[model samples]
Target: MASRQTRLRVISLYKELHRLGRDYPDPSYNFHGKLRGLFEKNKDLKDEAEIEKAIKLGEYIRNETLALYSLRKYRHLKRMYPAVSPTDPFP
Candidate 1:
């Protein structure tokens, strides 16, 4: 039996990941569905150590996904407003 802390941690992580999926670029890829499936696949873990390890992995994935979204947004903005060269003085 998993401790209450572990259970709460797992639920929160799952919710946060699903929330993050809202901003995912490709709807057809079904990011939320994949996340759900991953959580379901791990629902039978009986060891605290194993659960913690899985939680850590999920956090890592969340951070990476966030970075990816941030990069995409940055690229979009950069394209809209090209950076001016430092050597070029303003008119």
Candidate 2:
């Protein structure tokens, strides 16, 4: 049934979001709590269209979060190991 499919999709999204929350760097930000609150606030949504929209938005957020994390990681690596110039004898 459509409702069952929707339920599965929602659960999948919830699990993915929670997993990402675990990977987030800032514990003080309480990413998991905020993510849970966002879903809880919209738990009563009765319209399939609205639910789909929310799912899309959540996916977008997930992608953006991943990109930002990658960028941060890259910056950290760059700082830890700076580029060596050809003219420099030692790094």
* Best-fitting candidate, scored by TM-score: 1
Query: Which runs in model 1 stand beyond 4 Å of their true positions?
Result: 85-91
lDDT of 1 by residue, 1-91 (tens): 9999889989999999999999998889999889989999999999888988999999999999999999999999989986788887882
Clashing pairs in 2: none
- Across 1-91, the per-residue lDDT of candidate 2 in tens digits comes to 2398888988898899889888788889999889999999888988888988988988898898899889989999999986899999976
lDDT values for all models: 0.92, 0.87
Q: How much is the lDDT of residue 1 in candidate 2?
A: 22
In order of appearance, the predictions have TM-scores of 0.89, 0.85
Candidate 1 global CA lDDT score: 0.92
Candidate 2 error regions (>4 Å): 89-91
With a 3 Å backbone cut-off (N, CA, C), the pairs that clash in candidate 1 are none
Ten contiguous residues minimizing lDDT sum, candidate 2: 1-10
C-alpha RMSD values across all candidates? 1.6, 2.1
